[model samples]
Target: MTSLVRSIWGEPEERKLLFKIDFFVLSFVCLQYFSNYLDRANLTNAYVSGMKEALGMTGHDFNNVNSMFTVGYTIAQIPQNLLLQVIPARILFPVNTLIWGCLTMVTAAATHVRHLYVIRFFQGMAEASTFVGAHYIMGSWYKDSELGTRGAIFSSSAQIATIFSGVLQGFIQVPLAVFIVSWLQRPSTKNLDQLHGIAGFRWLFIICGLITVPIAIYGFIFFPDTPETTTAKYFTEEVGLAFILFCVP
Candidate 1:
């Protein structure tokens, strides 16, 4: 069993390097992607939870808003990839994430469906690089044999976050309901909508933004650029040079 595992994972030194890469690269990207998925999916929650009625959204308003986001995503995807060639992943990924988080926070202030359209468009543009950029960074650090496992982990983080977003919404709603009851109550009003005139949709965006912005900060501090360009404290010059030599055909 030990020999079989070693055969599958390479020698001890390779395994150590793999472990470091997983810790530095996969872990940070997983966290960033988790926040990205949460922010992306929370729009649906916002729509159903209170945004539609608050903004007087009707007809195909939801579809149109989604379409606006898709347009931004499509427009930015190629450009974002091109930009990544010139910018370091550590700088590019975190900066985009921070911008997206700010956009998500701005989403909480949306007063109309048009506001949503604008915010979602830019939000989508900000997030356009996350998935593709992470994949590109993963490829830079991982060998072909290691990519399958790391890729699976990176991809699944988003799915797990989708489920967590619902739970996060639930948690946000609890505090929001309390706040509404305590501060928004009127003599003639029995519910938040009657007193505050809006559902708690705004809070959802704010909380998601808060979650995202901190992770972006963390990413800037810890995210490994690429093996070739990384400044990770553990992966010294000798290790990086050795790895480069090992990869040459």
Candidate 2:
């Protein structure tokens, strides 16, 4: 019984390598997932808060925007995943993240529903790689039994971001209201229907974009591409070789 348990659980060195993989891969992927969801859902918050009125949106404009995003996301899914095979994930993942984050920031400049449709569509294409790509990287590092739990943790990050999105909007509103009233010399935005102040719903997109950009940069610098391709110093040559040999099969 003891021998069986030891064989399944792995030796101490194997456990240590697993921890390292989990810490680096899981943390980066999870943060990226969180930011991705936050960017996706912020539009809803913006619409209800002020963006809909500000853009003169009517009828099914909001739904149309979402549909455009979904269309772009669906279209990119296969190509992006296939591209992942040819490109280094360290480059592909972060570049995709940077593109989406830039598109998210550009949402601040949208003056009409048409503009939103365009931005969201391209943003969707940029983000299409994240979940699948991250899963691929995780699979490269973690064993079959280990993959499920880590994947669950990574997927749950999106839900966590959903919860965090509302709080982030509320938190941003407070400081923005203060800055507008005190520094920008604008009237209190409390009763405004359509956003007239400098710090409108646009800031939500901008802030989310800013937060995502840094994370993307971090991933570019530190995210281990895969066991076979990674050059991160933390994963020494021996560690990398062991992980590839252990997990590749």
Which candidate has the top score in lDDT? 2
Candidate 2 CA-lDDT value: 0.81
In candidate 1, where is summed lDDT lowest over 10 consecutive residues?
A: 1-10
- Winner by TM-score: 2
Residue 159 displacement in candidate 2 (angstroms): 0.7
Model 1 misplaced regions, further than 4 Å: 1-10, 175-199
The TM-scores, one per candidate, come to: 0.84, 0.85
lDDT per residue as tens, model 1, 44-154: 987888788888999999999999999999999999989988999999989988998899989888888999899889888888988898999999888788899889999
How many Å off is the CA of 2 in candidate 1? 27
Assess candidate 1 and give its TM-score to the true structure: 0.84
Q: Against the unseen true structure, what C-alpha lDDT does each candidate score?
A: 0.80, 0.81
Per-candidate clashes, comma-separated: 0, 0
